[model samples]
Target: MAPTTDPATTDLDRVIGFTIPGRHARGRVARLGPVLHAILSAHAYPPVIERLLAESLTLTALLGTTLKNAEGQMTLQAQTEKGIVSLMVCDYKDGELRGYVKFDAERLARLGKNPSLHALFNKGYLAITFDQVTTKERYQGIVPLDGETIAQAAESYFLQSEQIPSVVRLGVRRDAQGMLIAGGIFLQHLPEGEVGRERLHVRLDHPEWQHVEAMGATMGADELADPALPLETLVWRLFNEEPEVRLLGGTSLARGCRCDATYIQQVLTKFPETERAEMADENGVISVDCAFCSTKFPIALADFVPDAL
Candidate 1:
């Protein structure tokens, strides 16, 4: 891919949506900057684990933005008991994103510089969940993490669960300034079906889908990682040959950690007195650390909680 020269700063740290009228395809592009670095730098993880988390966050952004609901939550989790990586989770809600990883460092060191999806997670599965706030409903889809990359697993989710023809590409690497930047592109053809089975299935052999998939494939890793390239320019570069391409609204993204003293205390109050007491330090203060952001909240029982209650 050629280097990008477009001066589109607005595209940074956000997800941009678009659709191709002639191609009957729609997609989302997410390029993260400070948000990506802030999340990864907070933890001292191996490069391979960092890359996996990067891709997870990128994919979450891509899939989360597709929700029409203004208050929906999207979560992606990949985990296995007998692998280098025990669990990796990333979630998105209304432009807020937070994620973390739990892995076996000793097992991870056993792998090479780079590890395949199966190598990282043996007999693992990728679960994509969406919590629709308006409808008060939740839906989840799980698929075997068989492919070499998370992108391939996502395509499987679309095929087996959503039944949409999809193409996904994700990349994570240091830029010219040595800052970690993550970017991804997702494309799916408009579904039109077969007249066969009792249940409808997307026609896997549509010319329109084939053409769109070909266009999506041409998107290079360099192009996705370049921060200078405006998202509009990125999409145009890929689908400009089509009759028409429309760019939708964009949403800014930031790392979100919903941890606070009051919230922690509320949770603590519900626990058994003995359990809460056990959690307290010698000074009778419960030090709560957020799993996502690693922020610490210390609450003193002396003043905050009554001895009788």
Candidate 2:
């Protein structure tokens, strides 16, 4: 979809950015329909895990889309040494998004109905990473994943890691058609310039941030997840009274995974001959499956792996 400047218009699977000029705050609103269905349906994960992944995807979009023009990727990963869910990853590159979750089925089954994040990922830590492709700069922040949901974890990340006063809210639901729809809103009081940032640092607990966050906190999950509600309307409803609410429309997002047969084959060639042989079947074909997209790639061993190694 082409970029739109109108705040009243809406589209499926797009992230819209907005700013409250007087408050010195900026935010991104994400409303995803087809994108969420495409991602969750590919895996058909259990309901419990699906919800967790949904939250992860929404949170990823809320933060990832902020990487405006930079050709880079934002990745969120949660891991634990001992837990039902050992690992979960949600990545966004450009406007593409993908997610992966690994858990012990037996352990997950023990949870009755609703499993809290702490119960599912005991001692887990959430890691948010930003990798700028053009600059080759990578920055990561790790915070304990003790919150009830990924949204809460994100709030903790901004506070402890980014040191930015921010508020994040995410919602996911299965529509009547059984397609997963997710939405998220994020608000941060960004400093105008270096001088302004220095002043902001000196007084990190500014009242303007508190006010913006309070207004954002008033937004409920139902309103956010409503398929009929446009993102621009949500912003308007929340901050119309502010001096200025600047909204920019048109960053389309889709289900995305970085998987290439040739690239996979290249990586396999470096493996030892014995290891490569073990990966092959009777037909000498190595079947590699991508956890992100659930696509299986059968590469002919002779196509890339030499006899020597």
Could you tally the backbone clashes for each prediction? 0, 0
Query: Which pairs clash (backbone N, Cα, C closer than 3 Å) in model 1?
Result: none
TM-score of every model versus the real structure? 0.91, 0.91
Candidate 2 residue spans exceeding 4 A from truth? 1-10, 192-205, 305-309
Question: For candidate 1, what is the lDDT?
Answer: 0.83
Tell me how candidate 2 scores on lDDT. 0.83
Residue 245 CA displacement from its true place in model 2, Å? 1.1
Error of 1 at 105 (Å): 0.8
- For model 1, the stretches where C-alpha displacement exceeds 4 angstroms are 1-10, 192-204, 303-309
lDDT of each: 0.83, 0.83
TM-score of 2: 0.91
Q: Candidate 2 residues 25-58, lDDT tens each?
A: 9998887777777787777589999888887888
Put down candidate 1 lDDT per residue, 1-309, tens digits, no spaces: 222323355356889999887777899999987888778877888899888988889999999998888789999999888877888889998888999999999988988998899898989988999999999999999888868899998998888888777899997777766777789999987644556542224345667778888888988777887787788888988877887888898988988877788888888888777787888889999898887888888988764555475
RMSD per prediction, one decimal?
3.7, 4.1
